[model samples]
Target: MTAQTGSDGPAAPEVSDRIGGRLLAMSLVLVLGTFMASLDSTIVNVGLPVLSVEFGASVTEVQWASTAYLLAVVAAAPTSGWLAERFGARRVWLAAVAVFLVGSLACALAWSTASLAAFRVLQGLGGGLLPPTGQALLARVAGKSRTGRIMSIVGVVPMLAPVLGPLAGGTLLEVADWPWLFLVNLPVGLVAMLLAAWLVPHVPAADRASRFDLRGAMLLSPGLAAVLFGLTDIGSAGRNTPIAVTALVAGAALLAAFLAHALRADRVPLVDPRLFRTPPLGAAVLALFVAAASVFGTMFLLPMYLQSGRGLSAWDAGLMLAPQGAGAVLGSLLVVKPLIDRVAPRTIVVTGFALIIAATVPLTQLAALSDGWLVAALLVRGLGTSMIASPVMTIVYTGVDPEWLPRASSVLSLVNYVGGAIGTAGLAVLLELRLTATGDVAASFSEAFWCVLGLCVLALAGALRLPKTAPSR
Candidate 1:
């Protein structure tokens, strides 16, 4: 990739052909890092039931295995850019890998649910850094023009994780024990650490003489944690308790405070509020938030439909979900970048959202009987998701100045997690309410699917606001 200076400063030296091997090695390391981080999100889900039985814990208690990890990821995400800028991306990335490996080991060795939850939090701390760092590295390596293709390849992991997590987890659970789920990360993370240490070029730290914004970090991290925690608590709290209401209210207030603090800070803030002034960047952020809501919301509901509505076993549900990942990979490989080059990104995003709407419309019509139509719907939805994912990110990254890359990328990552939490919580509450009112699980899931379908339509509307062409930097 060719390197050109952005308005901020001179660009880092491009990786030359002499270092092609090194570039390939670093890319592999990044992909591995991304896979390790994303795999944990879904892998633990399939093991939740086994964990409940093994620990003699209630279903609600065991669910924390997933919830705690997600909350930890949210808490740690804001620090990634600051940490990378202060310490250097290579150092922060290696530290993150080490933390992940250690946390995975602790999780494997844990004897109780509480201990496992704590360890998962450590793992989240490590995992959260991978995405932003990976994106930054790719941005540097691929340069300005090829950012879409490079990011598209990296983007496959998030889509694949839902499918691979359960497949890997189910196979491991059948063959061995639950701890192996955590144990699996050790080898992959170690390899990534080694490769990153060797192949990633060292960029000089950002003018670190500039003081870190500790106050902003404090507010953003806990505020995000509280918000996600409150949302996850809704299912257990029945959404009516004073405690739940208070947690949600406090979390929202803190987040609002964090926003105000970020906006007014004289020094560089943890998140750069000025990026939002750019029209494309602002719209891209909103589109990412809504896209995440549409995608993960369906993921949260689909497996439940397969299990409770279709009466498939956990393993079978996982097997059924595999096609979605396959379709996503296929779509990415075939259409994502080429289509973006030929058409406006806004057009691609709008088309993607429309496809999601098309695919999801069929789910509302699902019956007690299993058939090809359900599988077809999932495949099409995966295609729609893949179609939008990479292009949306490319728009976000390419829209801003290079200095703001980290901040913009971090914001997008943060929105994704928050959107996912909201989506999962909102759909779960809707499904639960419907199930309570009507005895049929299928009917409830069908109602939830339609809600998701509506969200996709909303995302399409937001996509319309995206620039018809890539903006000049």
Candidate 2:
């Protein structure tokens, strides 16, 4: 294939003809950074209770550690493209790693809940950029023919991280102090940095004269953070609370303002809202949002059911979900390739969403007799998740111009983070409300299932709207 350059930068050096040693080495290095960055999102989950006790704080206070990180991540996502363009991808990537390492170290030494939360925000500053930046790096090299398969490999970390997080955290806590949770990233970070420095390509920076969209950034970052914050509060306090209601409305209004500004602005917006005019990119973005919602909701609820509902230990709860991880990995390895080659990408995604709905049905019933049944359901769920997630990613760039790849990545990442936050918070709120009426765990979880099922159904509808073309391969 002839190489085609984008306005922002040169195309990645071609690797399809020689995807062996050096390519593999480069991929491993990139995946290492992606995996480590993704891992931090959930690794602190099981540690929440322990940290709560250690700091003599309530669950609500300790929750900020996670919340703060999430908010920072959402805020940082839009800037990734600009940063990568202004600096070099290699330099920005290395800087992100160094920042993440420093944040992790600070988190380990945090003496109070507030201190921990502050450091988590710092950590998120780095964590937020990893996915989109890493994807762009891979996308540049993989080119059109190889994007789907390359994404399948790159997509593994985000899907697998949540599943593995609790297990790793629980295991570490068993043998060491809570600080080990953050400390653990040190070696991984060091190794990833070294590999990336040595193996990752040194792409030249784009020569665009346009500066970062500070105006758009002002509108988007705080707007998303406020909306997410409001969504999170819905779980703790009812929707009617003055704080939540005010935040939600203000956030939505701000986002609307940003959208209008982006549509008419002379300068490039943080993300071009006009991109949604493209049917494929729009459908893919919508599908990704809904899919992320379901994934995050399920990840949030399952561990709770296993630990609190089933009276299992944290370690055991994490272990119980291991089958889902296995199934997801298997799906990425086995299901994505053949289907993308033969079937419409939309069909694959719609089928995957259907499987998610099917898997979720049993959870709504919530009165299963055996662990075997639940495990099987989760296995199917994992397959469905991989099918939808990988395909949606491959399709997101369909109508997108090459110059906009970084901005596109930012948009998707922003949607992904927001969708996850809503899904997690929305489901938790539903579960809490259900339990309020009937103290029965099974009944509450059953009700919560309907909420997530609705989300998957919405995703299915979006998938149906996707364009009819297969990926470039």
lDDT per residue (tens digit) for residues 55-131 in model 2: 99987889888878888888888898888777766677778888889999999999999999999999999988877
Relative to the true structure, candidate 1 reaches a TM of 0.93
In model 2, what are the clashing residue pairs, if there are any?
none
Q: Which portions of model 2 miss their true places by more than 4 Å?
A: 1-12, 15-18, 237-240
| Per-residue alpha-carbon lDDT of candidate 1 for residues 27-139, written as tens digits (9 for 90 to 100) | 66787887889888878988887899999997678888887898888888888877777776667777888998999999999888999999999999988888887777666
* Candidate 1 colliding pairs, count: 0
lDDT of each: 0.78, 0.81
